[model samples]
Target: MVLPLSKDVSGKGVNVDQGSLNIKEVIDLLNGDAWVRLVASGAEGTWSLRHLHAVIGSQPPAWPDHDWIYGDIALLRAKLSIDRLKDALVAEDCRRFSVGSIEVEVPEVGPQVGWRRRPSFEQHDRERLQKPTWDLRVSAAQTSQHQLNRSGYLVGRSCPSFPDLQYAFRAFFEGDFSLNGGMSLPSELMVIRVINDEGWIGPIHVTPTHIDVQVDGRDLLGASLELYSTDQRTTTDLNSPNTVTFELPGGLPDTNVWLWLKKDGRWLDYRALYRPWATPDQLEAAGVKIDLPVDPLSTIEALVSGGEGPQVEFKRSLPETKSKDRNPYKTIAAFATMEGGWIVFGVDRDELTVVGLEVDDINGERDRLANLIRARVNPTPPFEATPYVIDGKQIMVLRVDSGVSPPYGIAVDPDAKDRPEYFVRRGASTYPAWPADLREAVMSRQPPAGFPNGMGGLGGAFPG
Candidate 1:
């Protein structure tokens, strides 16, 4: 339960009435630089609360048993003291108190500049107090998932087999009653925790219509699956053994589903699920271009005018497969090794012109290209072959996906002792994969860091 201090920060008044105290009043008090004291008289004792200070990332000597001290110092101290206040209130011992009286040690100093403080906003009057240990669990759960590309085709998360996502919690303040500026404020504090009751859920599959997930080897008689996104949540009861399928009301593309859980009546962490999902901002920060034009004409014009880059390649005609120079197999292998991109045929490489293909059968050529890729590229990456008419010219675009199986290489010889050559794309040209590039591509294909072989497979059936 949170007891709001007085409106005056000069240690002059106390608000104890449970009917009138507002959250904005409390935020205004904490957002100041004045030193506030909680002077209380209860059945067991009469005392004032003392505050502690700790640096953002340093372990302060005051909290000796704690491994580390961090987070908002004022809020941390307030949270700790609030736990005590709550205990007294629950025991019916905190009878009367002044929670917002200003201390004499800290003079009338205004709010400090270039410092962190919770902004004054509308909030619940009663706030939940959390323990220092709570931070570790949340951080661990969030960082466990592997980073993958944000494919427009997939709207669900991929996790290491039986991901150890811990039980999650949410804390907030809810106003119950009100109080005057000088008296004690009385409220009930609630701590809510959501347990992942089934523990393991997946080998999940999500399509445009429904989500199907296998429960963690547990009886699903009373279980349910939930899809949460964009401040909206929908839950569906299990209809079959060891699995639950949820029909999305708004469809998959409109809702980026965050949680795919098998639970009885518990909630999951939205933030933890969000860590594996890449936002456009996150992609840009990682140097992945996300703002490329979607229109084929505009995109092709830009590609032709700007020449080629890491993700865009142009060829005057079909790849010269007989020679190693400017081989399409190498380009395909490079796209698989890096973030996937396009290979455009019927475009002049040097002159930057859209010279259409002279082929009689575009469909046959696409099939031949597919066959060539299958025969030449080992452990082939997924791609889409489509013929487009740009400038009244026939052009082929092979849209490749970032390979799930990486360090893709081209077959050098079906009978010789030569290694299949790996390739990568850098700065507008296909190049031999450097040792580090090969290593990173290999690592990226592996299960996210920390999962061992005993864990379930890392693959999940996504839309892509």
Candidate 2:
């Protein structure tokens, strides 16, 4: 039994130096007016003498007696004794909340009966789901057991602080088991909340044949949800009120994408639904082979063998062709604005031969191309201009990856700061992207997760 030291001892306090008191002596002192303080501080809260004695001494009749017999109480250190007291109190509270009382009636005494453990309060009540009481009870029992199996005699004084107990309690109430110092809680006990705008969004699952996204919200029922990238869009109306399954269309360019909700004839703000779980590892685990970047020589060979197509363009020289339609900058913009392609300088498209450049300084030529791209292409895309030696011929191969931020454009006038013109590649030729294509391009790169929608309209303007 444990009790707080009353400041008003009235000279009745026992000399603690005369230690090793028995259980009866401790109970007598606590039941009387003068009690020994088990806790060092009063801020730990007060416990009544009767509550302490009953928890340590009382048991139901025919209760198949356990290790915690009366003699075991005599050997308990102050900290373990206090922990037991706390556990009993929390368990009592749980029992009361679950079944309206801590008292449980059992069968009459008989021989050869199975030893029954006390019923956990959850067995009594399941629907109400009083999580706070359940969490506190479990944490208290765990703390008591942890203190009992220690290494040293410091068990008498060692106890977790009030704040530590509170943190454990909160950890149990939430879904975070990591905060509980290696204690594993059951998965069903975890309560997690996913924060999102319209509703909860599950992980974006990507496989070779399909990409699936699961979204759920009561407000989204019968509403249209749109998932789009540079050149593709997939829309679906919610049929299930709880979770709507979205099977995104195949052939999406490798870009970070967004999900949009159409409401009141206008598209609401878009947000990225990709989490850390949406990784290349996940795709590979599902039997999707992640293609690495091909070697430049290998790509050049493939382009030469295949000739000019939608994703490959050949240029004979550096300063751009005399015809505006054949300009190298237009090809760069087209590759960036559409699915990306390569611009091979020093390659004659008509003859399908690598004629090679005559420049002495290859690095300087690369820098010139880089500077021209910066001046000509608005919102510069990721590209590489490298000098490759193929069969003793030097050629400049500029490879542009598919743009994450799309609608990349070429300047209408390099000397002026006016809006640039957008273009796309089709079958071996580059041309101005139509109004619809430009809209899709602009929609491909939405404002990132939390920023407000800054693009005023979807007509022809890009997000500033």
Candidate 3:
């Protein structure tokens, strides 16, 4: 029932002001294959209840006997009305493209019945698996929803224009919520080409787990895709640390075929660009600007409040020397050997309370811990020990990156059985590194593909 102001001089897309317009105009435009962009605009001034009446008045008899105004053309609530038109037009066999939120009736009237309220689209098209829809989705997955405006975690090419092409879009929870942070990693990125709008509609933050491509009513499966960025881009491929090179078919940068780039690698501090779909104006090309994540404090707060998982753990104090099981070294060694993670200390594990400390004398404590780590472990892992105060309570946050050289263990006695050898953090606890884990740690040390310094290749011979 909504139509944005057309991009042309006469606003030929829809004639809202018409007192008695011919239906042929609608049919003729559809025949020419104009995109169905239902954005609400000033055309509302001229549009009365009649426009919706026209769409519903023509509903065929075989169509469900639902009232027009009460059913498909009910209160135009937010972005949902656009898709209501989509469903109706699709019934008439017209192809439609939709963006932003979709409107769906809960407990769809059929054998299978359930309700998934809010922004999730799954409830609407599970069995039908709506085809040929391209998703460039970005969701703000963590605990509290955040504005992508000037976010610290994401990088973009140009300053985002505004709400349309801007990053301050909202994302919601999918079932796979993180217990520690309660935020899910964003998985899908949906980019829409709109009409008369300054930029693309959306591709907000989402949980990192949902990754896929659906274009032209088709699902893209098992296709080889690659990410391209400048050397200055600070990109982290969350899926893995291994370098990935994409091999494309002959005609990219020139085809209408849709491309998808999920939030697998994060970039910041510069313009981020992805050329996935052809613009509605096919002759012209443009780079889509993406939104970034929230600031560090919010991220930390979410993680600390979340349940312990493979990536997070809490410690009452520093690692104990005599008590092999008492030290945090095992966990440190484990994180380095596996996917890098975060460790928070000075919190009472039993109550998860932050008890302030005077681990004062910063340099002294820093030196002591540094020396202790060097003396106690072999091939020390890459880490940074940051002791800071949160809520006026002294605590330390230890960050461990998966090591360049791993398999680090207790130095003195490498074969000790009581304390166990290399350790790894599983769901919520650290355990002796499994044999498979050990093998992977060794392989992680190998230089990625062409890098020669760690490979004992040519770079090693040219000493400083």
Candidate 4:
């Protein structure tokens, strides 16, 4: 009873039926030319690769132990064919048992539809010119016969075996080789250890529909695979031909897309690859361009053409270096507290014109702006200071982020005179965020408010 007790009825299987195999079947296979198809790693040993001569074969298995396991006929009515079994074994195993034997070829199965860009998106000069063909060749079919071993694909994302993957989990890793009741290892049978995470034995393979693993040729200690779902046109990392990569779609509104990989029964895989800057087109359409990347004068040139809105704001010349008003900390706090935006210096807010600033010391001026935020703002939000000379006028562009911590304000000095703390963006103007606005900012995860749509109060006025 204890022999089968460890078998989890709830375990997930990829194309795995987990059907019954009787002791008679095992004995018959032992006498005949049958061997269990276990996915093998010469170094890491075998993972959850178990097969009953029903499918493709694999070899070496470099095992320390493997005892036959099967469900009794009285308890489980699993079917097995002795005659068809031998042919399948010979055909399956020794498909080049070593990684050195691997010949580069696309698997019989092709990449899935989502893996490749649709024909509609790529067939024209305009479309083709606008969007380069996203190559789907990076992801490859599982070089290891993990599937034939009866371990499933994806599901919990066993990782893909990259082309150069050669190392295995040392004996120092975890888990022991499995053996059933009173079973002796036959000299003809090879023993192997099962490699798995949190009881899920992953014989993972790389495919476009799946996440790529083994980056730059190293196995992460229980690495994670995440998939971001966006509009199909979204940008992905740059890579060479045959380098495996997946895509985060574009055009659709930004969303939080997640693909969780569980290792050791705990989920932990966090990494960020892209910076969320509005595309040039996105900025142009919205009539606002905040240089988050802190680009040079050419990129900053986009701001002169458009009027300010919720995402964009403006400020007049500073009162003094490190002075309370030098950096617009209160408004910066509001922008951080609400939706993130930009505040441009060397421009007249009242006239909406690029009136130049008289500059003697640029570094001193930059330090002043930096220090003001360091002093006045409560939980200062992240912002970039990009200096540009536009048409002979010196301009300072500061791009800000929606704060991770909400309720940013003038916590530095309640006694500071004329300091407008706890403010928010209301269209083209900045004003005090009211009790209601603060409540809403906390509730909405600090998304930028519209003056009418995001913030509150009249057209250009900030609500108390």
The 10 consecutive residues of candidate 1 with the worst lDDT sum are 163-172
Clash total of candidate 4: 22
Residue 363 of model 4: what lDDT? Answer: 59
Each candidate structure's TM-score, on Cα atoms with residue i matched to residue i, is 0.37, 0.34, 0.34, 0.36
lDDT of 4: 0.39
- The lDDT per prediction is 0.44, 0.44, 0.37, 0.39
Alpha carbon lDDT of residue 154, candidate 1?
A: 12
Q: What tens digits encode model 3's per-residue C-alpha lDDT throughout 387-409? A: 66678767666666667666766
> Model 1 segments beyond 4 Å from truth?
1-294, 320-326, 414-418, 433-437, 440-464
Could you tell me how far off, in angstroms, the CA of residue 353 lies in candidate 2 after the best superposition? Answer: 1.5
- Which tens-of-lDDT digit does each residue in 391-443 have in candidate 2? 88888877765566777887776765477888977788888989997887566
* Sliding window of 10 residues with minimal summed lDDT for model 3: 107-116
RMSD to the hidden true structure, all candidates: 17.9, 24.7, 21.5, 20.1
Model 1 lDDT, residue 368, Cα: 87
User: Which structure is stronger by lDDT: 1 or 4?
Assistant: 1
Candidate 1 local distance difference test against the native: 0.44
Better of 1 and 3 by lDDT: 1
Tell how far residue 295 is off in model 4, in angstroms.
4.9
